[model samples]
Target: MRPFAFERAPDLAAAQRVVALSASSRAETVPAMLLAGGTTLLDLMKLDVLRPERVVDINALAGRFGGVAAEPAGLRLGALARMAQVADDAGVRRDYPVIAESLALAASAQLRNMASLGGNVLQRTRCSYFRDVSHAACNKRNPGSGCAALGGCNRQHAVLGTSDHCIATYPGDFAQALVALDAVVEIEGPQGARRLPFAGLHRLPGDRPDEETVLRPGEIIAGFLVPAGPWARRSRYVKVRDRESYAFAAASAAVALDLDGDRVREARIALGGVATIPWRAREAEAALAGQVLDEAGAERAAAAAFREARTHGDNDHKPELGRRTLVRALLEAARMEI
Candidate 1:
């Protein structure tokens, strides 16, 4: 919308240098953004929500970081890998159905083809207030101003991991799968390379709702590492929405189960669409371990997932909806022939 300079980065080092220069000099109010797929960044820019003075196009670096590898150790997904490529990979579909399903069920076919895995996880909230510049009270768009969703139309906002400062939900489905699988995010920055737990990448909308991820100023996501586990083969992602197509989730669950003759040996649960972040339900997993995988156990686990959920007036039904979604996903995953 506004005038901005753009350059195609030949490599990661060049991209990092551009970001460093932008940070050192306060020439732009917003930090220089690295453009991969441009699915999220471009959309926000069009909405006038993000106004970076410069954008570093990183597609040139994809040749070096876009490969997807399936190894005996685990799965390694390059951050630059397209969603469609990862979703349709035979190895991913076979061993990590939840990951594939999450990517496939996201946005649409066109978006999946263009969106990168790294950018997908970093997608911003789809809250109307945050997208519409007319709404001057969005805490995420304008920090310390106010959260319009707090007492306004909040039926689509978060019920879990919410705070008085903000209630906007993390809208991406893939991040939920990553959280459930205990994926590690590889990041590179001016300092050096580092790996972070995928679950720890996103921050709660605590007092600073504007500050979302734990990424440093110039950090770029290199890839994601998912450890191979017995449950990975029996995982699935279930989403509930207002429509069958192109609709954001109102409630969703990523469930991975390992059963030992009708008894649960291990379970991993992560909730989306009803939380402020990619929410891992460790309490729910604890409830399912050693328990028989049945309707009663599923319900118990679902209850544990939403045990601390607090909702506003309009979204008061989310906790119940989230529980039902989790229950259904667990049952579906349990029935899978793994």
Candidate 2:
């Protein structure tokens, strides 16, 4: 890692000042990245993946942005809120089952406690080529360099929303669940505060595979507001992996459906492990609307989920795997009866 100066910001204003200073100092616009729990960021620094000239420590502002508050409309999860705190909170478990399940099914207990919700959402994908410093052609790590995963070892890469340049998968379990619940993120930047839908946060790798997020210069996510809806309670995050333990998803689905009598009233679906972004199955959702939850309906919904998937090479199996995962997720959510 390259040597750099480090400082702690006592409040949001001081943090903004630090960022502004970095931006104006002939560095990259929004030059300094905020330092949170150092779970993922520090590791990248050590790997020479991110060599920031200055690191702004936000630990002092931790208490201000790490609280969970429940409201009639929905829950507000602060950006600095620890994963363990949100996952184990009774309100999250009772009100947002998908969020709770996703967190509980993620990394080990230690990581969950150390990693914050915001950091987890913004975490990089686990693509091997993207992580390896040896892979000089990783487009995600360096723009216009090229993508080795295009025709390389890409069995674990994304199938949906892929491009000729990149095929890396989105690798967060909790974000998938949040996408299912239609969460919106609040961000503060030089342009002032703005709210962005969770779906809009990530971008598909078109030409600039390096730029992944919708965040502008110096924009930092403040918190997340998951809109409370009918399906928030009756939700489940089903992950199918190589193992049943703490492993990344081979195919995962987060489904939240509101059952009215024997028929589906509303459905919110987002998939992981098979897409470049949180895959929202709008067709599958439409297929299940006003339909009874039966074997046929489940299969139809699952099939519709992958209607437009553009799988190729070794990832051709993902469409089917994703279908089954969604079906299983819907079935699991139906059993919730909440």
Query: Please, what is the TM-score per model?
Result: 0.97, 0.94
- Clash totals for all models, in order? 0, 0
Task: Evaluate model 1: give its TM-score.
Answer: 0.97
Question: Per-residue lDDT for 313 in model 1?
Answer: 91
Q: How many backbone clashes does candidate 2 have?
A: 0
User: Judged by TM-score, which candidate is best?
Assistant: 1
Q: All candidates: CA RMSD in angstroms?
A: 1.6, 2.2
The residue-by-residue lDDT of candidate 1 on 245-271, one tens digit each, is 888999999999889988999999999
Instruction: Please list the residue runs of candidate 2 whose C-alpha ends up more than 4 Å from where it truly belongs after superposition.
Output: 17-31
